[model samples]
Target: MIRYGILSTASIVGRFIAGIKESQAGEVYAIASRTVAKAKEAALQYDIKNYYGSYEELYEDENIDVIYIPTVNGLHYRDCQNALLHHKHVIVEKPFTLTSIEAQKLFDLAKQNQCFLMEAQKCVFLPTTLQLKKLIEQNVIGDIRYIELKAGFPGRFDYDHWMYDLSMGGGALYGSATYTIELMQFLFDNPHFQIDGSCIKCPTGSDEICNFQLKMNHQILVSSTIAMNVPLKNEAVFYGDKGYIVIPNYWKSNHLDIYFHNGETKHYDFPYQSEFVYEINHIHECLKQQLLTSPIMTPARTMEATHLVETLYQKWQEDTNE
Candidate 1:
């Protein structure tokens, strides 16, 4: 079994650990946190075999074959770089890096170390998303010309959290927008996307809301909006010539529906225990074949998403300067 080392005791770590246990390919053997007390608490809570006070110590363990990093947004690059230097296969949570440059460097580092490296963008590996991609290719939603992704929350986030600090790469664009931005490239088959226009809000130190109107060179229009403290519909929609497809909470889509011009509606469902399992299993299969990069979640795909969001953030800064 692949011995996985987990970083941090973040809330998401619990779900990830549960998923690893569900998959037969890997086990959460070791974990680390800034404090041994926190690490020990997580170890006891999740039944992890080993715990360390610092990430450096965990990365030094020879028994750990892979490391799953769920660290803060700003720390992903440095943390991943350290893990790769130690020759550990790595899977870091999404928005892989704050900039495409950082992402490129990490992918290059992985190559130098000859270690498997992937950003955890699980949506692309989801069954429902795969079904949607198949349907699009089959032209069930004939000639998709426009796509819309909308998401947000209804309450204010704590200003003290790392997610609210722009210096640490905290913002709606880097955090929530990662899903829609990357999922678009995946569904559209890794096309080059260009930003046509943008409207970003920065009520706090970080961007609280972001809007981007994008165009694929093929003339496909993509519209995306992500916000904090707003209650817009949290879904993704594709508008086609014949019909439209809707996936509620598109990031973690379980099922979706298509409405036909003929007044017929079709539904697709993919039941699952933990949504993280599909991505984990995909990694397992890749390792079984000795592949360093995930074919589905390629580094280029991640860089594209990072580039797009970074561009949008730049637009936000330009607006502030104006």
Candidate 2:
């Protein structure tokens, strides 16, 4: 079994650990936190065998086959870089990096180190999402033309939470927007897209809302709206000449419906499982095959998503400055 080392004691770690326990390909062997007490506490709570006070110690361990990083947005690049330098495979949380440049550097480092690296984007690996992709490929919706996606929830986080700090790469655009942007790319099979839209920033200089339109090569139009200060119907709809496809709660959808212009509707319900299990198994398969990058969530695709986010933030900044 592949021995996994966790790089943080963040709340998301518990969810991931649950998935690891459900997976047969890997096991959570160690955990690291900023303090020994914190690490020990997390290890005990999770029933992990080893704990370390510093991330460096985890990296130094030769037994760890992969390092799972769930650090804050601003720290993703640095932590992944350190793990790669130590010749450890890395599975990092989404919004791989704050900028495309950082993402490029990390990919280069992973290549040089001969280590497998993947962005922990569970949506792309989901059974429903895979089924959706297959259906799109078969042209069940007939020549895609437009896509509408909206995902958000009310902002009720503590003032000091990292989500409210722009310096820490905290913003709705980098948070939930990662799912929206990547979903678009995955569905359309085009990472080369342009964005034209605006954003609303909170007093802390972080974006609370963003509305944008993405245009892909064949003139496919995608409208996306993400906000943290407001609640919206969270779904992704694909419109085509024949009909439309709807995936409610697209990020974690377990079912999808296809509608035809002939007034026919077909529904598909996939077996429900923790969203993390699929991606964890995918990573494990890649590691076994000695693959450096995942075919489904390639580094180039990650850079493209990051670049789009950067572009949106730039537009927000320019508008705010004026």
What's the TM-score of every candidate structure? 0.96, 0.95
> lDDT of model 2 at residue 322?
95
lDDT, candidates in the order shown: 0.87, 0.88
- For model 1, which pairs clash? none
Highest-lDDT candidate: 2
Best by TM-score: 1
Candidate 2 per-residue lDDT, tens place, 59-121, comes to: 999999999999999999999999999999999998899999999999999999999999999
What's the C-alpha lDDT at position 163 in model 1? 78
